[model samples]
Target: MDKFILILANSQSHFINVIRISIFIVMVWIGGLKAFQYEADGIVPFVANSPVMSFFYNKKAPEYTTYKNPEGKTVQNNIDWHKENGTYIFSYGLGTVIVLIGTLTLLGIWFKKIGLIGGLLTFGMSLVTLSFLITTPEVYVPNLGGDFPTPQFGFPYLSGAGRLVLKDVIMLAAGLICASDCAQQIIKSKNSISVNRAKF
Candidate 1:
């Protein structure tokens, strides 16, 4: 038991690396999906309602509600509307950024500077995503009238979208951990250089 405890205590660095790889896998996979029409359309509510991102869309929020397309299902009218709204274009740009961040984060295994940038970027992205819970009305279950009182519909009750966005909290923490590790590495490298210089 003592030996096992010691082993686990010394594995923090390895575990942190694992977290970095995990973030990479998740970012790349989701980012790649953004290329699809369905994926592009699905993010309408979040982007349209976002105060920071709304400028990317031609159409406004609430207007997006009427044009919402079910995932993996398509309507010509909806597709046309999305095109006019720059949904696909924005999605492509966002996807590219996400993939690049992931690649940089993964490269942290070999290079600290790039890793630090990636880590901070990931944190920023996660913060934006989590903000959707507040900005996007679709994140919570609507008060759809039922025979009985819909007690579960409201702010405390999260919709599927909200739940999905909530998962970003983990990514937020992982980003900080990765950033801290990279920062430590950079400082250590600088200190080594200083020591060598003093010896000369």
Candidate 2:
């Protein structure tokens, strides 16, 4: 056990590198999906509920409230309007930014400065995703009738989609770790350069 622990400790940096690469791959995959119409429709509720993001839709339009289909059933029309108003364009732009961050992170394997920038960007993106927990009420369990005293106005309980957003916390920590590693590398390189200059 002691020998195994020693080996693991020695390879800690390698493990961190693996985690960094894994995060980059996740970003690239999800970012690519955002360009599609299905993904644009899927993100509608999250964007509509967000105070910081609600303006993306045209609120004054007749379709903003509800639309009656040919069958005469009223349905929320945001999805249709979102599609028409270039939601896919917005999604594509977001995807591009995400891909750029991942690309910079991958480049960090060769350049510490670029890696540090990528790490910072990743951390910022994590914070944005995590913020949805506060702004998105859909994440919480709906109020279902039960007993008189026990109103099922779910607060602490997370829905399936909420759980997905929660994973950003882990990503945030990983970004911090990657940034710290890059900072250390930068300091070490500077010291080495200074020492070589002194020798000359």
Candidate 3:
């Protein structure tokens, strides 16, 4: 038991690094997906509903307003307009930014300053994503019992996309941990240099 504890303690830094890399993979993969039409279309509900992000869409409607479908309409007109209004471009741009963040974070394994900056960026992005929980009603499972206002499936009862966005909470925490670790490493490096100079 003692040996096991000691081994676990020794592996803490490695575990953290693994977590950091995992976040990088997730960010990069999801970001890359944004460049595609399907991915862009999928995020429409979340973005369109957000007070801060609604401007990205061509037509601004209320959070739950069902757009009128034209007669013989096989396609969703609102979504079509959304795609035409540079949704793909916006998604591509966002994807590029996310990929950049992940790249910087991965580089942090060698460069502390770069890593710290990447960590901060990742943390900020996580906050932005997590905000969707409050601003986007689609994140929750709607109550089947109607007539009255439908109660949302809150917290642990997150719907599919809700689960996806909620994972950002973990990413946010990981980013903070990585940034703090990098800062400590930078400080220790500086101190070591100072001590070496004094010895000379």
Candidate 4:
């Protein structure tokens, strides 16, 4: 475990590329599960809140309505957007771009240009996830119609909007780490190329 942590902490270009690939694969797997409601895994928060959950609950085409905010305003959850817009559209549109860029980084193909695009995509996801983690609870959970809504899990740490939000923050941090590493590698590669040309 120490060795594993040390490798990740070193945070080199190759290591960061591995991180990007791993994150994307996990995202894709989660999205696929969201696309098809398999068994519920407690680790996945979005899937639990999905319209697909209604199926698990034995409903006939149940609509996913989000909990209202403290201000009594309705909001759309992430699963709602995924269902309405179509998972493939969201996946290929944003997901494919990120994955392709990440794959390119790992392959060392067009490192500077592709890495820039990958870093940008990762940064954008980081920002979007950060917003979801921060703003959505204030806008949705208060409307669950209770002094205090029941947590998703039995334990405090395992349940509650705060815990879900914390997970998103963790994902955002991972994206940022990937982006920073890619950007640094891009710059370093450019410098190396220039140095090689100068030597020639």
Residues 1-200, candidate 2: write the lDDT tens digits: 99999999999788878877987898899889888666665565566677777677644233322532322232357446655665667788888999999887777777989989998899998998888899877678777766779655667778876888899999898888888889999999999999999999
lDDT of 4 by residue, 83-194 (tens): 4534333334444554554454343323545655555555565555445443332223443344556543222333355554456555566666765665677788789999
Q: Comparing 1 and 2 by TM-score, which wins?
A: 1
lDDT of 3: 0.79
TM-score of model 3 vs. true structure: 0.84
For all predicted structures, in order, the TM-scores are: 0.97, 0.85, 0.84, 0.49
Which residue pairs show backbone clashes in model 2?
none
lDDT tens digits, residues 94-186, model 3? 899999998888777889899999899989999989999988766788666666464545655688889899989989998888888889989
Which is better, 3 or 4, measured by TM-score? 3
lDDT of 1 by residue, 47-82 (tens): 999999999999988898888788768989989999
Reference-based lDDT, residue 144, model 1: 87
Give Cα-based local distance difference scores for all models.
0.93, 0.77, 0.79, 0.47
State the number of backbone clashes in model 4.
Answer: 1
Superposed on all Cα atoms, model 1 deviates from the true structure by an RMSD in Å of 1.1
Which is the leading candidate under TM-score?
Answer: 1
CA deviation > 4 Å runs, candidate 4: 1-14, 37-112, 137-162
